[model samples]
Target: MSDNDVRQFTVGPDDDGIRLDRWFKRHLPDASFNVVSRWARTGQLRVDGARVQPGDRLAAGQTLRVPPPESAVVAAPKPKAERVPLSPDQIELAQEMVIHRDAQAIVLNKPPGLATQGGTKTHDHVDGLLDALQFDGESRPKLVHRLDKDTSGALLIARTSRAAAFFAKSFSGRTAKKVYWALVVGVPDITDGMVDLPLAKQPGTGGEKMHVDEEEGQPARSRYRVIERAGNRAAWVELQPFTGRTHQLRVHMAAIGHPIVGDGKYGGQAAFLTGGVSRKMHLHARRIQIDHPDGGKIDVTADLPPHFAESIKLMGFDLSLGNAMIEDGPPPVTRADLKAKAKAHAKSVRKERRGERRSRGSRD
Candidate 1:
């Protein structure tokens, strides 16, 4: 089609419920996001004779009307960074981690010591190797959530933009259920308990460390049930976080005086154990269950990593007993619930600050 001609296209079955902007990226790469937004603002972009925004979801049979391309109206496309090609071994490693794969999502049993995404000093990560996992998808799979570098378990990757958006909503809405298995240094006095503590990034720690702060901390909650105990020395526990916070499980366990085994960052030297227990972090994302974009639920469980499995065996605990204690939990906290809690926390902080100022004035 000529640049002077207005374009009309029908959405396909494959793109039945994808965002308008995503359709363009998949089918019309020349039409940049800026170009689409400008057309929408000018009332020239339409779907079924109705002016539509970039985020509007399109149906399979819907008609899309696009204005004629303008040379000046479209911004110059930015240069994309060159992706380093993965080595043959890297591709094999990525493929080996896949525990579940479907049309919408891929679940990988990420092993310990592998970073989810690359960073300043880190070049090798699951994100860098996603190109090998593209399979039949038009675009590279997107990461829906993250795990710590040393933590191993079920990591979900969205195969398409629509799936990515859906999975992201499930997480942000707190509808996704994640179960974790960790071996803590000591057994908790209370076998099953909730750690309802507000956490804040510790001062002078470069935002890398979190500590409990009743005064000005964000709300973080975790529930743990002791599955089995090896005397008072250590225990295997099942963990579920109601709110997602950085290093939440590790911090919450440590704060409760039962730091996760081998988590030296938060647990210090006490995190380790005697009698030939491996010093590697024993946290593993045991299972993940969430709603799928296509229809039913996507519930995947990851096998224990080598080190964690070894630790469990050394502790003389039966692996099958871990899932026997599964019990129904209260409905996951919604986004609105979190907002209300945060607002209350902010109000409390303000009241305390005001009280301190009034006390100083009275002293003066």
Candidate 2:
């Protein structure tokens, strides 16, 4: 292959610190791992003008250069899927999920067992049915954040790419407040408190589980209030997670001796109740508050699902409690902050800037 056939890509913020081989699989799925390593050995895989091994991690804003493929076996890139579409059936299904909608965003009371995004075995998802929420003729409604498949509740969708970017920054900046409602097997000893635990992926679960770990875990925090309890059988709890880690709430609650009801993954058999309660996971993303891309605060709430409603009714728990809007957290990093972060990230990606950081102390 000649130099004229080269292609280049800039590492995206989300892909930062990803292994080069994994990045290739994600962006260039047609390229095999053996082919990537061959390019590395032949000095054709380069990052920032220097040859890089496939094991090397890629950072945000880094320039990666790709040499021409050595084999004709590589398949041509497929045309990108046009903006999402909804069949008449999907439109009918999704129409019932829309609790709120506007020019900039759509709020869905996503049902349990429906995935927010497609996965290996998940072809049916809220992301695929977004055309139902397409306000205008253009069908570009985009998902801003994800709700766990079994956990039903509010899922926000941005109506445009500009709004998508804005909402994405809001979540990354930790300015969005999301409130979850769950029924736990056992009541917490305290009525209200915070669970400060570091979490790491549980081994041998194939990336589908989480557990508390002190040394090699990511920091996670969740504030909770036990709204009501039914004779030590179960409790209705409101949870607010400060850090958005996978399975944080489930693992945290299980670690605290009160696993969420019907959470067989983390809570084991104890999570099940004998008295005919639906075995479905009882967690719900009841409400969310985030800054709107256009203007004002986009605060929305969702109603309970069938199983959750049934459990609440049988337990005689106060259904009206804790549904009010929550106060907004710190405002999302401003546009100026985002720009500064991007600039700093780009500079840090340069090898020369590794040893050139400014002083840590304040000037004052």
Candidate 3:
């Protein structure tokens, strides 16, 4: 392709519904985002003969008209980061964690204490070991969702970009269902209830902690049902979070006054327990159900980690009783739904007050 000639490309099925800028990044590596933005700004970029923004979604079979590459507008290429080689042991460890694998997805029974992704002072993580999970695929599997460092169980990985996008939509749209198991301190008075609370990053915590803030916080809701109680000491419970937030499960459990065992960050000293119980976090992603890219659905369950299993055994709780409450409930309500509900409640209150006033006037 010469620099003077305009370029045209057809969007593929796999690239459907992706942003225009992302399409550029995937197919045209030489074109930087800045160059693409410049082209869009000058009306040199068109999709199906219509000018489109960088964030515009592209449909399959649509024609994309790209202007000729201009030397003055294109930025210098960035140096590619060197790929670190994985050791044989690391590869084996990664493969061992895989509990379910298909063409589109790989679900790992992630153990406690392993970070989902690398960060400051964190060298080992599931993201780093993902290269071993790439089994003859064109690209490495991508993480669709994350589990905290001390939280164990099912973590989904997408094997292709299309699958990644599909799984991400399921999660963001709240269609994907995730069930977690935890042993919390003290049994709740209510056997089953929903915690409709908002959460925000705690001040002075450097964004590492979350706290319940009804006044200024994002909406967060969690449903919990006590499965089995070990006297008054602790209770094995099933938790389903409707909204995903930072440290949401931990923060919600702690806010309800029944912190998950070994979660010292939110629970403090009360998080730990007496006797021979392991001081490791008890929360585990027990099950995940989401629609697959090709068709059908992916419903898989992860076995408990060693410590969690041991604690369950120590508490003498029957394993069979854990999944008694697996029936699905109403979907999570949106902000609009909440507003409508509040309006209806206010109207009902006003009607009741008017009736009370009328009855009092008749008595007088």
In candidate 2, how many Å is residue 261 off?
A: 0.7
In terms of TM-score, which candidate is stronger, 1 or 3?
3
Question: For model 1, what is the error of residue 134's alpha carbon versus the real structure, in angstroms, after optimal superposition?
Answer: 1.3
Model 2 bad stretches (over 4 Å): 1-75, 79-86, 324-364
Candidate 1 C-alpha lDDT tens digits along 332-357: 57899999999999999999999999
RMSD (Å) of each candidate, 1 decimal: 7.4, 11.2, 3.4
Q: Please, what is the TM-score per model?
A: 0.74, 0.70, 0.87
Give one digit per residue, the lDDT tens place, for model 2 in 1-364. Answer: 7678998899886566667997888788888888889888988889998999998877779999997655425877778877555678889999889887888788899999999999898999987887677757265588879988999999998876556657777787688889999999888998888888899888898878888989999888888888989988999999988889998999999999999999999999999987879999999999988898668998888999999999999888878776643543333347899999999888878745544443323332
lDDT of each: 0.89, 0.84, 0.90
Candidate 3's TM-score:
0.87
Poorest lDDT segment (10 consecutive residues) of candidate 3: 324-333
**Model 3, range 109-152, lDDT digits (tens) per residue?**
99999999999999999999999999988899999899999999
